[model samples]
Target: MKPRFTALLTLLVVALLGGCASQPPLRQAKDVDLARYMGTWYVIGHVPYFAEKGDVATADEYRLKPDGDIAVTYHYRKGFDAPEKTWAGKAWLPDPADTAHWKVQLVWPLRSDYVIVDLAPDYRSVLIGLPSRKLMWIMARERQLPAAEYQRLLAVAKAEGFPVDQVRKVPQRCEDLGQAGFEQP
Candidate 1:
């Protein structure tokens, strides 16, 4: 009985700690332009989860597949010595309110939320969020942008309550870009 109580107490503590962890919040699309929003985006920021706590310079691209469903590819740079890690998934627009925003039903659909938040005026960059807003990814056409424009977007993200530091600079791989389709106009 003593051992069992100790184990139960430990489990409770872990659960409580987990609950207290910070996460990105669910955000509404201030505005969306479907045509401009379509295309690949490099992930810049996300709330940390236990599995990939030390990842950096990660990015993701979203494309509308030939069949109309959405294709998602996640890329992460694990430590300086390790090669980038990549994963792919499929998603679709589910909201009757807006077709531009979507819900991805990947193998581990419940594990992540893929919400398209903001899009560039010219459709160059986009902001996405996991369902819980615990994770977010900002993608752009260029690996780097003008400092002023970048700062403006960062401010927008901050107003939305995301950890701005999580938005890191992702190194572009031309080979990967070839795999992602052009942004729909």
Candidate 2:
């Protein structure tokens, strides 16, 4: 093989490998108040999922069940004729440094990644983060929040280095399939 050709091939390989790597900064919330974080949250936006975008006007509600397990309610309206779909799960704090961090095991005992990445000053809104930062969610306590508030959270996310373009408005009702999930308090 010619030396020039070998050099070009090596550069191409390096570029391809670098492109395949994931980029997510390692940062956790500094102060998390679990109690204030609990409540029903409507999914305003989230990272896109290629497989299934089946829920719209999605909301997640959390409360301590009488049995001591954190009860989670995943609700979404599919369409006008389709009734809302609800999935329940249990979550528990696995780390002490940040009680906001929890592991949620659904019906199959499979744990979905969960992290508290953004919050409002008074704890009225929140953003959930996945380990890779590729998956993120913007949530509000009410189904409808002020436009200014939503934009404010978007700015915070951009400042934190999230891919803002990937964020899109989630449907308000199952009339359209939107994505949503619960964030443990």
Top lDDT: which candidate number? Answer: 2
TM-score of every model?
0.60, 0.72
Clashing pairs in 2: 55-177, 55-178, 56-178, 57-171, 57-172, 77-174, 78-174, 79-174
Name the Cα RMSD for model 1: 10.5
| Residues 148-181, model 1: lDDT tens digits | 6666666767777667766544434433332322
lDDT (10s digit) by residue, model 2, range 1-185:
44334334533433333334366643556587666677788888776553115456688888865654577878765444667767766777776566666666544424555677767777778877665555667889877668798888778777776787778777775433423331111
Model 1: lDDT of residue 5: 46
- Give the least accurate 10-residue stretch of model 1, judged by summed lDDT: 176-185
Please identify model 2 stretches exceeding 4 Å from their true place: 1-26, 50-52, 66-68, 173-185
Error of 1 at 155 (Å): 1.8
lDDT of each: 0.54, 0.64
RMSD of 2: 12.3
